[model samples]
Target chain A: MQKWADNRAWFLILPVFLVVAFSAIIPLMTVVNYSVQDILGPGMSVFVGSEWYKEVLHNPRLHDALFRQLTFSFCVLAIEIPLGVGVALTLPRKKGVWASTCLVLLALPLLIPWNVVGTIWVMFSRPDIGLAGVTLNEIFHFPYNYTADPLHSWLTVLVMDVWHWTPLIVLLGYAGLQAIPEAYYQAAKIDGASRFAVFRYIQLPKMRGVLLIALLLRFMDSFMIYTEPFVLTGGGPGNSTTFLSQFLTRLAVGQFDVGPAAAFSLIYFLIVLLFCFVFYTTIVNLGKGEAQ
Target chain B: MRMKKRTVALLCYLIFLLLPIYWLVNMSFKTTDEILSVFNLLPENFTWANYAMIFTDPSWYTGYINSMKYVALNTIISLTVALPAAYGFSRYNFLGDKHMFFWLLTNKMAPPAVFLLPFFNFYQTVGLFDTSIAVALAHCLFNVPLAVWILEGFMSGVPKEIDETAFIDGYSFPRFFTTIFIPLIRAGIGVTAFFCFMFSWVELLLARTLTAVNAKPIAATMTRTVSASGMDWGGLAAAGVLTMIPGAIVIWFVRNYMAKGFALGRV
Candidate 1:
C-alpha cells in the first residue's frame, strides 16, 4: 500500500488558494488594521487599541440590532425547519415527471435575487394596490401597512424570508430522505412500526446530518440578512426592522465611521464563527454516536 | 393509500410556492393603470410594454448584461480553480493539507458585509474598482470554497481503485482526469456551477458597492429606479422579470443535480 508518489498534485490546488487569499485574506487584514486605529482621512491614523471595540459593544443601537437579529434568526429556524421537513415528507419518492415538476416549482423562489424578493414583497404588501395587502384588508377589513406599522413591518419581512428560503430547507431535507435505503422502510413495516414510530426512529435519525446542515446554513444566512430588510422596510417604521448587517452598513457606509464599523464587523464575524463551531462539533459528535 | 395523502400535501405546497411568482408574472403583463386599479389574479388588460422597455433601453438591458457577464465569468473562474484544488485535496496529502482545507471553509463563513469597506479600498488601490472583474473576483472568495467542498464530496465517492487502474494502464494524470475522473463527477460539477451562479447572480450589496455606473448590476439598478423620478413601477417590474431569466434557465438545466448539491456536506 505504501508507494512513493510524485508531489506535482499540489500544483492543482495552488490557483484556488491564491484566488481565495487574494480576495479574502488581504481584505480581511486591511479590516483588522482599520479596527485598531482611527482613520481621519487618507494616510492619517491614530492608534486607538480596543477603544472602538468598547464603543461598539456599549452602543445602544448595536445592542438593539443584535437582539433583533437573534430573534429573527431563531424565528426563521423555528418555522422553516419544520415546514421544510413536512414538505419533504410529502414529496413522492418514485422518480418521474411528477418529481421533476415538484423540483422546478420548489426552486423558483430561490432563483430570484434577494433584493428582488424584497421588492416583490414590498409591492405585494402595498395597502393601496398590492395583492396581499388588498386581499387581507378587503376580506377582514383590517388595515395593514408594513411601511407605517412596526408589527406589520416585522411580519412582512419574516413572511418574505420564509417565502424565499423555505425551499432551501425542503431541498436539503428531500435529498436526505432520498438517500435512505428502501430496506430500512421494509424492516420498519415488517416490525409493524406505526407511522409516528417510523418517522421518529428511522427517518429522523437518518436526516440528522442534513438537518444540521440546513439549520446552520439558514442560521448564518438569516443572521446576515441585509438586502431584503433594506429594500422592503428601509430598516423601519422606527428601526423595528434594523438587523445587525443593516446597522453595520449604515455605520460604515452611511456615516463613514471606519474604525467602529471595522471593530463591529470583527465582533460580528467572531459571533458567527462561535455558532458555527458549536454546530459543527455537536453534529460531529452525533455522527460518531451513530457510527458506534 | 399513503400516496393519495402525499399527493394532496404536495399540491398545497406547490400552490404556496408558486403564488408569489405567479403574482410577479401577472404584474409584469399588466398596464400601470390596471395594476393600480384593483387586486385580481389575472390582469384586466395585458401588455408587453414592460418587457419592451427592458429589451429596448440601454440603461435597463446593460444591467442585465453586466450581471450576466460577471456571473458567467465568476462561475467559470471558480470552477476552473476549484476542480484542481478539490482533486488535489481528495487524491493527495500535502504540506498543511488539512489546515488549508479548514482555512478555505472558514473563508466561506466570513460575512461579506464585514469586508465591504476594506474591499472597496483594496480594489480601488489596485485599480480594480467599478469593474466586472472586481465583482467577479469578490464572489470567488465565497464560491470557491463551496465549489471545492462540493467537488471533494463527489471525488471521494469515486473509488481509489479507478485511479490505480488508470495509472497501471499507462495513462498520465491529466489524461486520466480528463477522460475518466471528469465524466464520473459531471453531476458534481453541474451542482457546483449552479451554486456559484446562484450566489453571484443574486448578490447585491457587494455588487452595488463595487460598481458605480459602468458595471452596475440589475440588483443595484433597483436602488436607482427608486430614487429616479417617482418609483417607475413598470420599469422596475420589467427589470425584475428580466433578471429572473438567467436564474430560471440555470435551474432548468441543473434541476436533476440539485438533489446532490443540496445534500452536499451531509454526504
Candidate 2:
C-alpha cells in the first residue's frame, strides 16, 4: 500500500524492534565473539582466525549429517504436500459440527508440545510395551524396533512428522477452498467442465497462494527439526537420525565445541537464508508459465 | 460410494493422528507397572494415582502454572507490540521496510539451539534468569516477527480509506486504532494471539534454559522425570496429557478464526 512519505511509521514499529533486538541481537553478538576467541583459562585465550571454520568444514560427520538432513527435508516436502492437498480437497465445505470436529481432531497433533510428541512416539514405538510396535511385530509379524534399527528409526521419524504436519497443509488448503465463491463451481458445472478441469483451473490456482506459504513453512520447519527426534532417538542408531540442527547442538552444547559450533551455526543460517530467497523468488515469480 | 471414499480417507488420517495420543492417554491411566510390562491397547487396570500425584505435588502442578504464566506473558507482549508494527508495514511505504521485515523473520529462521548458551549467559548477567519474564521476553524474539507477519497480512486487506474517514471524524490516532481499527481486525488479533500462544507454549529449549525452578516448564519437568531408578511413566504420561489440554481449549475457542488464519486474515 503506497502512502505519503512518513518516516514516522518507524515509531509504530519501535516496540517490536526493541523487543526482537534485545532477544536476537545480543545473543547473536555473543556467538560472533565466541567464534573468534579460543578459551583456555579464566580470561587467557588465543585469537583463532578461521581455524574453527576450516576444521568444521572438513569434518566428515557434518558431511554425513548434511546429506541426511537434505534427504529428510526433501522426503518431508514430497510426502506432505500432495497428501495435505488431497485431504483438503476431500474435506466437506459446509461449516457444521462435523467440519469443526474434524478441524479440532486434525489440530490435535499440531497443538501437542514438541517433547510430548517425542514422548508419545517413543512410547508408542516401544516393541515391548507399545501397542503399535507389538501389533506390528506380534500380530502382523512386521518386526520394527526404532531404537535398534537405523532405517526403521528414520522411517518412524518421517511417519511421525507427516502425522503431525499434514493437517496444517489441510487446514491451509481448506481455508483456500473455503474462500472460493460457489459461483465458480456452479459456472464450471454449467460449462460441463470435469472435476479435474475445475480443480486445475479454479481450485488449484486459488489455493496456490496458501499452498506456497504452507510449503515454505513446512520446509523451513522440517529443515531445522530437533526436539522430537532428539527425544525419540537421541540422535542414535549410529547417528543416523542426527539432522543438521541436532548435529549443531551436539557440537555446540553436547561437546562444548563453541568455536566450531558458532562457525557451523553461521553456515547453517546461510543455507536456510539461501533456501528462503529461492522460495520467496519462486512464489513471487509464479503464474508466468501457467497463465493459460 | 464417492462420499464414503472421502469419509474413509479422513477417518484413516484421524485414526493415525489419535492412535499415538490414545497410547499416551492409556498409559496415563494405568499403573506404572502395568504400563511398562503390558502391551494392552486399552488400560485394563486403570488408576487415578497418576493424576492425583500431579495435583498433590507443588513441583508438578507448578510446572503447569509456570508454563502458562510465561506463555500468557509472551502472547500478550507479542500481540501488543506486533499490532502497531504490522499496521506500519501494511499501511505505509516506509524506507527500508522490506529489509527490516526480512531481518525480523531471520530470528524465526535461526535455530533455538544456536541461542541456547548465549541466552543463559545474557539472562543471568542481566539478573532476569530463572524468571517467567525472562522466558517470556526470550520467546518474543521469534513470536514478535511472526505476530507482525500475520497481523500485517490481515491489516493490508483493510482499506486505507477507513483510517482517513476515522481521522476526519475527529478520532485521535490511538483512539481510532483501538476503537475503530481493532474491532475491524479482531479476527486478525485472535489468529495472531492463538499462534503466539501455540508457539510459546510448545517451545522448550529457551524456556528450560532460562528457568531453574520458578519458571521451569512442564516439558522440562517431564523430561527430567525420565531419568529415575524406575521411570515415572504414569505420572509423565499424565503431564503429557495435561500439556495438550490448553492447546485443545485454544483451538476450540479460535476454530473459526483458524480457517481464516490458515488462509493467512490476508493474520
Point to the candidate with the largest lDDT: 2
Worst 10 residues of 2 chain B by lDDT: B258-267
Candidate 1's C-alpha runs over 4 A off are A1-10, A283-292
Which residue pairs show backbone clashes in model 1?
none
TM-score of 2: 0.97
Candidate 1 is scored at a TM of 0.96
Please give, for residues A188-241, the per-residue lDDT of candidate 2 as tens digits: 999999979998999998888889888888988998899889888988899999
Model 2, residue A97: distance off in Å is 0.7
TM-score for each prediction? 0.96, 0.97
Shift in Å, residue B56, candidate 1: 0.5
